[model samples]
Target: MSDTRPWIYSTDHDDPDPRTPEPGHVYVQLVGGPLDGQLLDITGYTPEERAHGALLMSNHGLHGPGGRSDYEPRPGAPDRWAGAADTT
Candidate 1:
């Protein structure tokens, strides 16, 4: 099946250091398959989802450079984030 849901790469921050995550910032890879690799001010995720996102970041590292995990967007969610996929 075609995975239309957006994927999250790094929900940490657009900081110079990829190892550190900003306090309240999130880096979403795609929104409805658009705006890839954009840094969003706020995540359009529920409280539980937010927490899960944090865990995903922590467990998989700030950017998950190793392709550890892929986050899918919630159903009927709005696009309010940024981030592009890694080409290399």
Candidate 2:
């Protein structure tokens, strides 16, 4: 059982969404057996952001950091909880 879903928890915005990977922020990669099959392609962020998640997708999303993004929360999605943990 591998965990491929990566995540990033930040305090900059109380409740940060894992789907929205920001640059310069810290995150964790779901590597290993327990999470090998749950992968979320987050190339929409930036190279640095994707690096934070450790997700290496094809060249279909953002490459580097050099743009302004207005990330809006998805409709009907539950509000992200705020807390601190091992964002590795």
RMSD (CA, Å), candidate 2 to true, equals 14.8
Worst 10 residues of 2 by lDDT: 79-88
Model 2, 70: alpha-carbon shift in Å?
A: 24
Which candidate achieves the best lDDT against the true structure? 1
- Candidate 1's TM-score: 0.21
Give the per-residue lDDT digits (tens) of candidate 2, residues 13-43: 4554444556654333333322222223343
Candidate 1, residues 30-51, lDDT tens digits: the string is: 4422334434333466766643
CA lDDT, every model vs. true structure = 0.39, 0.32
Report residue 19 deviation for candidate 2 (angstroms): 17
| Residue 18 lDDT, candidate 2, scale 0-100 | 48
Candidate 1 lDDT (Cα, 0 to 1)? 0.39
Off by over 4 Å in 2: 1-30, 54-88
Give Cα distance to truth, residue 47, candidate 1, Å. Answer: 15
